[model samples]
Target: MLPSIIIVNYKSSRLILDCLHSIYRQGQEEFEVIVVDNSDDEEGRKAISGSYPVVKWIRMEYNAGFARANNAGIRAATGDIILLLNPDTLVEDNAIAECAARLRSSEYVAAGVQLLNTDRSPQITGNYFMTGGLNHLMALPAVGRLIRWLGYRLKVKKTNVASAEGLVEVDWINGAFLMVKRTAIDKAGLLDEDFFLYAEEIEWCSRLRRIGKLCVYGDLHTLHLQGESANDAFGSSGKGYYNLSDRKGYQIMLSGLVRIRKQFGAGWFIFHLAAYLFTVPVYLLVTIIRTLFLQPGRKREWANWWGFSVNVLRICGFVPVILSKKPHFYKVL
Candidate 1:
């Protein structure tokens, strides 16, 4: 069966075009490409459609975010295999075909390719489900080393699938290059629309795991230009991981709480929420100390952390709204 590649595009027209170019370069692959344009960029649509006349384009009435837009594309896909690919990524050297073939031959329901950074270094493409305790522990400085040591001692499964020797079973695969059989999607249902952005894939993967296995192929590589869309929306952080602007960080934390509540239970949700609340004062203390003696220029870091804490607390008021069955967009910005 041919694969249907679904790419959800926001305002990244140029990036999407580049992604399409990479896909077209893969020789003799009978696949359909669906572009769900959330921003309704007519100019981009014209440019892309002019070059690739076979490309299917779906324009949303408004900015529908990732999960909803991708759901729309999935519904319109004609192929049995569906790939949710990021617009900022470039598939390398038969990666898409190989990944699709791997999924077709294996018993796994869903699979992700190894993601590479812009410099071709391996990016973490798979991860274990986040626990409340691990989330809290990772917040503190120099805690990653301790977690790695403990993880080694405990023989806990590794989180990065790219480093594995072969097809590795994982808790969840990153949405950037996820390929799944249409049957699996039909059984599991579409991604939850409540999540406007981050953590939606994790929540979806949790549900997908209920039916069959999820794995990542270490040899299949895709270069992900991570955070370009995010940098456009929120000012550039100039660093990888853990350095997000106030609004972006707030959205992530808020969505994470929602995911925890839906997947684990209210107990895990409350634990993480309370952990965020508890850290407010701790961050405030650090902010004051840095302002007093340390590099004042670095004060933005603490302020961003404080802003995230404050916004998380603010979400408490909307708990009732979020819990209801009615549709509500969870965007903070």
Candidate 2:
């Protein structure tokens, strides 16, 4: 049997329906679809169920966030392989089968496909998880370029490929379309609920990596309406051509801090916090300059820095709570 596909829906009924149709049409009778609705509304539930009656719909009592919502579906899944798919993605022809075939291999613990944008251009293949120190410094654009140059000259930098002809081992694949073997899940346990969003997948894969190889197959591709659901969290204003809205951006930053605290230690969080604080003033000046002379796209870099500066304060002792409701507020998606 093929893998059980679990999609967490959050106010994307139309997108989810299109996603399901693509999967059903491409794979024929090879897979089962499980929809975990975090929209927390009967209207969405009714519409989805009424349209796709055969789907095994799991209505969440309330918005369970990404990690918990996916876990709910994982627990309910009966297949040997579990595919955590985003509701805003379309599985291309043979893509599902190809991913399942890769997961069936005993060598791979988890696998993901090449993600394409709406225009069918390639997007991020995958990324190495934040390991602190130099890796943390790599987040700074100019510093990152210098470090990459130095590492490449020293022949110590790891290669990241977006157009590989075959499966290649990677640090971690994006959560938008990840497939995992039942053995790996059993060994690694379920996704951590502490991470309401963002680095949840990175944390899970960090554990899974201990079991076996985690990789992305360049031969298989899928279309992702990137950040579609995430936009809803910040509302219409979040629709900037670049940069996330203040709320969404801060949530991601705060979640990264939480992930660091979980994966590394308090020391790592403090180190990154210091880095954030040091750069805030510098970026503030840059934001002003860009806003004055550069195009609108450049303004996003400004927003990112400004947002990070504020989040640093929140993380340090300035604010008692990151989100007023925090984990629960984050769950509303």
Candidate 2 Cα deviation (angstroms), residue 148:
6.2
* Segments of candidate 2 deviating more than 4 angstroms: 133-159, 236-245, 288-306, 317-333
Tens-digit per-residue lDDT, 167-274, candidate 2: 678877789999999889999999988667777887798889888888888889899988888777556343212332366655666666566665776677667666
Estimate candidate 1's alpha-carbon lDDT, on a 0 to 1 scale: 0.78
- Could you say which candidate leads in TM-score? 1
lDDT of 1 by residue, 53-165 (tens): 88999999988888999999999998888999999899898888888887988899999988989888888898776555354235432333456688889887555554644
Model 1 segments more than 4 A misplaced: 130-133, 136-159, 235-241, 323-327
Estimate the TM-score of every prediction: 0.90, 0.85
